[model samples]
Target: MSAMTSAKELGPVRSLVPARLDRLPWTRFHWLVVVGLGVSWVLDGLEIQIVSQAGYQSTLGLSAAQVGAVGSVYLAGEVVGALFFGRITDRLGRRKLFIVTLGVYLVASGIGGLSFSLWFLLIFRFIAGMGIGGEYTAINSAIDELIPSRYRGRVDIAVNGTYWGGAAFGAAANLYLLSDHVPVDLGWRIGFFIGPVIGLIIIFLRRTIPESPRWLMTHGREEEAERTVTAIEQRAEAQGVKLTPVPESKALEVTPVVSVSYLRMAKVFFGDYPSRSFLGFSMMVTQAFLYNAIFFTYALVLQHFYGVPKAHTSYYFFPFALGNLLGPLLIGHLFDTIGRRKMILFTYGVSGVLLLGSAALFHAGLLNATTQTALWCVIFFLASAGASSAYLTVSEIFPLELRGQAISFFFAISQGAGGVVAPWLFGRLIGSGTDKTPLTWGYVIGAVIMIAGGLIAWFFGVDAERKSLEDIARPLSAVARGVPGEQSGPSEVTS
Candidate 1:
């Protein structure tokens, strides 16, 4: 359980990275990877939604379950990607695997954009889903490894936080660009193309991305780890800051083996790391259930339940997107300043309560459409703030040696379990012959899940604020939360 490595375990030093939060554009580097990843997802979302918004008549031609299958297909691919690519990256390396994932996406987007048949559409979307699955694992793990403990959550916000950015961009394309702006001939295809174009740019950025130094150190690359620490420190010092040496004690317990079998690595995830793995899985599960409910049910509430038409629904999502935008951007900062535990607990609790309020308001018809919209906006804001932090938190929990693989594992669970279920359950909820009154039940379920997620996070999730991730990755004692560990004032950060 200790993360200490022997002198012989480390590998070549690829680059020198500074470890101080203040030394470099820690936030910038943190945000860049996810923004790149999020852009692809956003464009994909927009493309998919265009199919929903524009092809509604066409979608309706299929059976209701069949309609749901289209979305499910994509989710299925994500599930596959999460499981397979997650482990692959742990073994393969971060930046390179990420580039490969992006390449996979570029191709998937192209296929989806140009698909001529319904089955083909589903197949390509599934492939794109796989790319998204891999993206979350690879990038989040990379950011988690690169960022200091202080900035883990906030920097991670760059990843989870920007998911909405993708949605917002998708929304812009859907509402402004795709809504009769592009040629009718192109319409949804234009939306799909957006991902490939943006994905190309993201792929280009991969040229400069470094592998996780922690991974280097764990693999016996102390030189790379030191380089990473140095570069980060140097950059931070250049910006007029000082760096501390990591407490020597942090790595004292890490056992060093020249190499381990991949199967052994997998066992550690389920066997030795089961507790943490469960935490990640739980985090993903909660997010999945809530998101599907929100995405799928929001439409039903407006059209089937609230009597709004499809044409007007996309525009209404504007306020929702605004809420999503502000919530994460704001929390992204708190991810560092406020710390992940408190921030997650606070938002999760507030959002759960607000969701219940929104449900009650919707049920009572307490407000006119305008009032309802305002209430919904607040709920989305709070919910997104809570949900967005999930990735940030999970990334911090994995050991550097395991960071990339850990990301692959957690994300696979998150996407496979959470992302897919949201829409599917919503369909079952709405399409189930409940006369739409049960729509309020959907909101209620979201409220309950939100509350539960917060509690789960508070109790089980490891705390990383104010400690080095190296320390946080150890057996996770209460001391990991920073009550003067074995070394007094353990942050030995110096260039």
Candidate 2:
């Protein structure tokens, strides 16, 4: 091993890496980070929208049950991937895992396009889901660590929201490819390659981005951490952006550990930081349930309830997706300015209340298909921003060492608890296409779930806006050191 690797294995070290990173002004380098890291969500959304299309059943000679199983299988892969790779990301470092994960998706999805059998396609779909799931943990950790604190909230929210853009793109692509314009066999196969083609371009761009310096500092590679920050500073100066100095008081003291045991992770999550744990789980589960329940069943509701034709349903998705896309773009800055706690509450609360009102109208037989779609657009305009913030909340609140694993765990749990159940339950409620009463109650349940999430956030949420990640949660590796006016020892739980 080299001397630098040896030093990382030694012991405690102190560095200003986080402070140095947070003090820099925004520049092209930051934009590169945003585009490179943020595209993961877009890829995920594309994969989902493509797989959900019905062309697959006719092309693969599959039953309706088998087609539904394919979607479930992919979701199962995401859960497994997040848990397995999340731990690897914490141990192996952010940049390595991100590159490997994206490559996994590229190869798996590309080969999946050529699949001739149901078994073959299912296997690759599972593998591709793993790649995207791992991307969630690795990319979120890297982005939060690399971006400046002041810009972090809006940037993360906006990036998470871009999933809708990819969804919108896939919906638009299906309009051409799935229609009679292309051969059915060729069109469905081409749909599978869309995300991989996009992934190829993003992988090249990701080559220019660096590993998280915060990850380096905590691992005892102080010299390398310093060098990385210096290079970033040089890039900012090259862009003619003046840089500010980071204060010595902003430096952190850390005792390096090669790895944190899962036991320790469990204790820290449930014991040391209980309220923050509650906050993260509540935020993630509520949004996952609401989004999955409504979005997955959207086409059914339109076709069954409103007597709309199945073929025209894809056209309605554009406006629905546009609202979701615009939400974070317009309202994301408030999370940074109005602050995380208040904005999360507002987004969740208003969206929930609006959903309840819409449910009442549907039950009373007052809404047409067009009016119903419009109401959904307005409601999710706010809910999409709130859902994106759920990811942001989980990513930012935990200690740096466990950041990736923390995200994976919550994502996995939420997927199991909310993502899996919501669709099945709602499908049952929308049964036989006759009664609006059951689905109306379903909407009320969804509304109640979201309102409860907002209330939980109001009571337990962290005031993380404008604060450095280290300030939000001290690393387990961090050593208590007395700064002149700052409180000594580990950071107190903000919730």
Give the root-mean-square deviation of each candidate in angstroms: 5.7, 2.6
Residue 344 of model 2 has an lDDT of 91
Clashes of each: 38, 0
Q: What is the lDDT of residue 280 in candidate 1?
A: 74
lDDT of 1 by residue, 1-495 (tens): 222232233312222232333234454555554555445445545545655554432422556666667777777777688667776776567777778888898898787777666677778888888887777677777766666666556656644655566666676667764455666446667777777887787777777666776666545555666776666556557767655554433333322333344675666567666666776777667866777667656766677666678677776777776777678776567756766667777888888888788778777767555566677778767667777677665666655545655666666666656666666666676774346457678779878888888887777766666566755654211122233233121221111
Point to the candidate with the largest lDDT. 2
State residue 435's C-alpha deviation in candidate 2, in Å: 0.8
User: Residue 21 of candidate 1: its Cα lDDT?
Assistant: 33
Lowest lDDT block of 10, candidate 1: 486-495
**How well does candidate 2 score on lDDT at residue 263?**
84
TM-score of each: 0.82, 0.97
Candidate 1: segments with Cα more than 4 A from true spot: 1-51, 54-67, 176-183, 224-274, 416-422, 431-437, 475-495
lDDT of 2 by residue, 305-407 (tens): 9998989999899999999999999999999999998999999999999999999999999999899999999999999999999999999998998999999
Q: What is the Å distance of residue 190 in model 1 from its true position?
A: 1.5
Residue 249 local lDDT, model 2? 82
